[model samples]
Target: MTASPTLFTRIIAREIPSDIVYEDENYIAIRDIAPKAPVHLLVIPKNVSARLDEITDAEEMGRLWLTAVKVARQHAADYRLLINSGEKGGQVVFHTHIHILAGWENGPDSDT
Candidate 1:
């Protein structure tokens, strides 16, 4: 039987609406629904790897980093690259993804 799709999979397929930042053959970058920083983007591979360790030596791995860097450069600002590998690692989505936090800003409940 075919495996079920993850949230990121649906997003990549355009089944669920997401603010798509960039996309190509192997990867797609989109704005995070729940923004952790002022500019939070999720760069994900189209190929389902589940987590970082799953595809360490894959060619797509390098592409993933390139894609993230490309997106980060667009902002021309300080940014942090994060990856939540497993469940306890704060990875709500099992699909491997790179989190681009471009800097702190007033969050929803912040005293701005």
Candidate 2:
């Protein structure tokens, strides 16, 4: 049986509305509905993975980080990249993604 579509996947299909920041063929970056920082964005891969650990391809992983970095640089001079691996690692959404937090005058605002 096919797994149900994830929230990110739904957003990718535009089924759910989101404040999209950046989007390309393989990734889409959107503003978090509940932002923890002054600037909080989630860079999600078009290809879905339940968790970061679930992805084993080196090139794919590198590309994901590259996409996140590209989006972060577009939004802020200074930013952070974060990934919550699994439920125990504080991941609420199963889709593998990188959080780009910025817009802080000082350094990182949260331990994350």
Best by TM-score: 2
Clashing pairs in 1: none
Which candidate achieves the best lDDT against the true structure? 2
Candidate 1 lDDT over residue span 1-112, tens digit each: 9778999999988899999888889889999988877788999999998899999676668888888999888863667889998899888899999999875555334532
lDDT of 1 at 56: 65
- In the range 7-79, model 2's lDDT, one tens digit per residue, is 9999999999999999999999999999988889999999999999888999999999999999999998988
Off by over 4 Å in 1: 105-112
Q: What is the lDDT of candidate 2?
A: 0.92
